[model samples]
Target: MNDSSADSFSPRLLRQAQEGGYRLINAVSLKEQLERGSIFLVDVRDRADYEAGHIPGAICYPLPLTIQARLFKRWWLKKLLCNEGCTNVVFYCQDVNSLRSDSAARAAVISGFPDVYNYPGGLEDWVSRGLALETGPCCEPEHHL
Candidate 1:
């Protein structure tokens, strides 16, 4: 999660994230969870990608910010990402090939969010499954609530 180009992918980071105990979630289960309002979905891709399209109700806490270990522990972030009776945290990126969610999942796990998960299918699988996406730029933080 360096200041590298947005196209960067870190396999090592992904491996470390999985090894850190964040679980993988498939698109089917992700959709079900979303329908039930039982998971807090976070899009960890770049802002542009998020604006282009993303899962509805997903909080656009982009890659570079979500990957930071510091923000995950803050009170404001906890309020933003850990709502709904401490619902599970699910981070996703562009697709399975991207490591943004994995990196963010690892950070969430390290921050003591015991129910963190990574959605590898991401926007691609979601769209392939005919699931809908909300196309628009991110709104103010208060709007997330």
Candidate 2:
């Protein structure tokens, strides 16, 4: 098995991630977020991967480059977020290290959203727990696949 930081789900490290302006949500907390209906869930993976499966209701937008390069193609993305009045933006990707997902969260911060977060375990974790997922275009051409 490939060793990864995601395997080390530590309370102390989670606290540090929070302090560094990144929120880490577990299956339980993620469930709570869904129940509350206050979070904007962003999947930072390619289109094919997303279509194969993903967390239900997650908006696929890829990451960093996509967010910067194709605003018009993803207009509705911003529109929904605007309507949600959401304070938290959650980003997730396939990689457990989630460096890309973390970068996406940082982009959200740069875009002026204060409560940006990262779900490092991503769809891997979501599916492993048997959480239902939604499938569709979910993203723009910028997804690159």
Candidate 3:
């Protein structure tokens, strides 16, 4: 296992960290998982970053604001709180070193989410691989001109 360096995390190193607790998926693996319908690919980037672009089918769940206090506390806990089966939840962020995806994974574990994964390369690596991403209407509009 490599030292946990938030600043210089490579996909290889990230894979090592993932072995212990979380399952880290790469772009190819994510694509396969998407086809299998066995994983939820979550984009943990900020709203602005998401507005710019994101993985298709990925939901905009900002890690810092929503993971622990909102999604887990409000939604995931309503069912059983502690016995939620280990479903596959995949988290991705703009950068591997960012606190967003890392904290998101930790929060998922704390929330009783069974299987938590992180996409270390994130959007940066995703696009680099010539993968197609989706873009939605930039933001909520006050009125439709």
* Each prediction's TM-score versus the true structure: 0.73, 0.70, 0.69
Q: Candidate 2 on 69-121: residue-level lDDT in tens?
A: 43433443444454446677787898575566766665566566667777777
Candidate 3 clashes: the total is 1
Which tens-of-lDDT digit does each residue in 1-145 have in candidate 1?
A: 0112212325654465559677777777788888888888888787888899999989887655442443543334555665535648888888877767776777677667868878776899799999999988875254142
| Candidate that scores best on lDDT | 1
> Which residue window of length 10 is worst by lDDT in model 3?
136-145
Query: Please, what are the lDDT tens digits per residue for candidate 3 over residues 42-79?
Result: 77677788878998878776544644555543344314
lDDT of 1: 0.71
Among all windows of ten consecutive residues in candidate 2, which has the lowest summed lDDT?
Answer: 70-79
Report, for all candidates in order, the number of backbone clashes: 0, 0, 1
Per-residue lDDT value at 141 in model 1:
53
Q: If both were scored by TM-score, which would come out higher, candidate 1 or candidate 3?
A: 1
- The better candidate by TM-score, 1 or 2, is 1
